[model samples]
Target: MAKYLLLIVEAEEAYASAGEAELNEVMEAHNAFAAEVGALGAELLGGEALQPTPTATYLRKTRTDDVHIVDNPAPELKEVVGGYYLIEAPNDEVALAAAKRCPAGFGHVELRPIWSFG
Candidate 1:
């Protein structure tokens, strides 16, 4: 078995333009999905929903041996990483199965294997 990180990205419009009722519905669905994933015996390490991008910060390395820090996200896109999940599964297929059940409106879920150091 291996641990994978499931990155959940939500369409900016779905989030930014969502009303309170719509947001509540999405959140309810997400919670249900999470519970289902947990029942599958996959370890849920941790996860969280990020705030809006306006509060994001960016940093980059410069050729002058300096690190330039900025006050916003690197790129302005229609989608933003909203949350993530760390799960243990036998293969990518299983991980993907869980990710597909997430409540993201026309959004996407990316699965990446975690590198174990030990």
Candidate 2:
């Protein structure tokens, strides 16, 4: 079996700026989707809602063995990676199916293959 990462991106400020009722509804939708994914026998390894983009840090390496670190996300955008799920699935198709059902709140879900050293 292979493990996949379902990265959920969202506009943190936009979400937080919404009305209380709207925020509640959005959260409910996400929770419901998570429950559905769990029912499919996919293991939810771990996930967390990240702090706003302002708190993010970026790092890069150069050919001369130089490393650069910055205090911003790469390709700045209104939406940033808010959370993620590590799941075991039979194939990419199954992982994509789950990603499609994620409640992104006008954002996006990126499905990436997890690289295993073993």
Candidate 3:
């Protein structure tokens, strides 16, 4: 099986002021997604929600050994990676199908196959 990373990309401002009920709905949807994906044979290795991009630290690297850690990316982006799931699937198609079922209510999902060098 191969590993895939489902990057949850979304606008941070939307969730920043989410009402209590809205938050509950999102949590419930996530729970349902977890159960549904597991039934489809996708093993969720690990996943987590990240802090806002405002809290992100960007490491800028150069060929001449220049490196600097900044608060965010060089060109600030509107959408940020809010969360991610590391899943193991039978193949690329299966991984994609699993990602399609994930509950990314207000935003979209990005599925990428993890490169294994061994």
Q: Best lDDT goes to which candidate?
A: 3
**Which segments of candidate 3 are over 4 A away from where they belong?**
62-65, 74-76
Candidate 2: clashing pairs of residues? none
Q: Write the per-residue lDDT of candidate 3 for residues 1-118, one digit (tens) a residue.
A: 9999999988788898899999899989888878877788889888888988777777878555788776555456667789988899999888988899877776899999999999
lDDT of all the models against the reference?
0.78, 0.78, 0.85
lDDT of 3: 0.85
- The superposed Cα distance between candidate 3 and the true structure at residue 69, in angstroms, equals 2.2
Q: Which residues of candidate 2, in runs, are more than 4 Å off?
A: 59-76
For each candidate in turn, give its C-alpha RMSD to the true structure in angstroms: 2.4, 2.7, 1.9
By lDDT, highest first, what's the ranking? 3, 2, 1
Error of 1 at 11 (Å): 2.1
Model 1 lDDT tens row, 1-110: 88988888877767777899988998898788878886665667777888777777777785657888876655667788888888887777777787777666748888
Clashing residue pair totals per candidate (backbone < 3 A):
0, 0, 0
- The lDDT, on a scale of 0 to 1, for candidate 2 is 0.78
Model 1 lDDT vs. the true structure?
0.78
Query: Which scores higher on TM-score, 1 or 3?
Result: 3
